[model samples]
Target: MKKILRVFAALAPLLLAACAPTQLVRNKGDAAALAQQAAREQKLANANHWVLEGKLGVSNGQDAGSGGFTWTQDGNHYEFVFRTPITGKSYRLTGSPDGAELDGADGGPQRGPDAEALMRRALHWEVPLDELRAWVLGLRAQGADAELSFGNDRLPSMLQQDGWTVTYPLWDTTRQPPLPAKVFAEKPPYKVKLAIQSWTMQ
Candidate 1:
């Protein structure tokens, strides 16, 4: 009886140890998957919102004021409409990344320094706009490569990616419920500033 008991006790520990790794792996995998899912949710939440309307202002060597601005991105094409309160004139601009074509809304021929610059300045907000899009809409941009973080509210800082950067504020958070409190591009001089007073996230 004693010998049989010892054999069973020894076998029990070996079985338990064998399962420890599997359980550990399973638990770890579940946790990792959850984190990824959360990141994805946040990304889509940021992008699915079809429109962003708020104020606009620029200060370069003492040029600044309040203006109305609307930004929208759909599929591969994006547009920005900036309205100056002082002038009450809004400029509507759009761009597309159709290979070398660089399509624009004005029915003009695409491709050139101007088109490239406009595209860069528009839809491709180097900040987590893509991630926001991903989080908000659950639509991942194929091989999109970006690292991200979050705050209890919209973050205020510069987002640097692939030699590019954009600065913006949390104008409004959602087609539903999330928004950037403030954001910035990694530019120079006023790269890290947030224009909060001139914004209404509706």
Candidate 2:
């Protein structure tokens, strides 16, 4: 009985911690400092190349799908791959300022002007690929106006950019340049969510 009581007591704090809200902002006054910190983080992200592996879910009002996702970004170039387990099929999309291309195992590469547009046509997923270049790095897309909301940890909790709203619920602090682990972004008629399992930076 005493041993059981002791065990319960020892686990109480952890249980509470797990239940506590992660997005609570205890110090609203820290917004400025947080913004500055975020800017520094963004700079680091933009000046370097990175890769992310994750699970992705997309919904477009009338349809929904999920798959394994991988993205590699270097300077102005990027390659995004998605594999759907059920169909045993993979899709690859590569893009740069020059243009975008989509290829599959059964078909030749198709070129398009924009990655997002290519995705909509090829995969029917309305992902905001251009804005995601910045959003994936926890920053608003360059040259676009945005509104940001910060959490207690002085990181972005939510961001409203262009026509989308992005939320950051978890950050992977273990990495050299901490990255977002779970990101959800949505706009009317389209929604996408990513749970990043790995991050590699160069």
Candidate 3:
């Protein structure tokens, strides 16, 4: 009985250790940095009214197009105009919470309840304008969970959310909150790139 008790006692600690819950150890510096990043993101999210002048490029593994664009946003309303240099043609997408409209396509003006659907139907482009609104301001989109990696400057270098990977290659640090100079997003077989030239914040 004594020998059996000794063996049982020796195995008890090993059993307990195996059943113990694992705890993740997070560094204090990393936690603080993440908190600061969250605060910055919140600030940018509040900036709903702004204008961005940039170049946009898109590819769908088969077809590709590039153009200069001006995006103006005021709360829930937005107007995006893209001008192709080669063809000297322009396309405009204007929308509010009520509805969305796409003009200057092959046929005529197309209206839909959603911007993404309208663009896809008229231009056959799979641009995610809803998420891009948040992303253009260096903020993450709502709804889905996102994974972020930071650059040496402590700004977001890359963000992964909603099946898309968006990268910020350059930042305009001269601005108060700092804006993205270049934003590139990809989901295999589809790619969208934006290069911002100027910003007008209202």
State each model's C-alpha RMSD to the native. 23.5, 11.3, 19.9
Candidate 1 residues 1-202, lDDT tens each?
A: 1232232333333322332211111121244444654664575544422665644433222222234556676665666565544334445656555532333323453454344344344323222333333322322333445333322232312233433344332324443333343434343332122222232222
Question: Considering lDDT, where higher is better, how would the candidates rank from best to worst?
Answer: 3, 2, 1
Q: lDDT of model 3 at residue 166?
A: 84
TM-score for each of the candidates: 0.44, 0.80, 0.83
lDDT of 2 by residue, 48-134 (tens): 487889877776765666667899988898889987655556789998899999987334677898888877776666898888877
**Regions of model 2 farther than 4 Å from truth:** 1-32, 35-39, 42-45, 105-108
Which candidate has the highest lDDT of all?
3
In candidate 2, residue 96 scores what lDDT? 89
Candidate 2, after superposition: displacement of residue 93 in Å?
Answer: 0.1
RMSD, model 1, all Cα superposed? 23.5
lDDT of each: 0.38, 0.72, 0.76
Clashing residue pairs in candidate 3 (N, C-alpha, C atoms within 3 angstroms): none
Q: In candidate 1, how many clashes are counted?
A: 25
Task: Tell me the lDDT of candidate 3.
Answer: 0.76
Name the lDDT value of residue 57 in candidate 3: 73
Off by over 4 Å in 1: 1-49, 60-66, 98-158, 162-177, 190-202
- Which candidate model has the greater lDDT, 2 or 3? 3
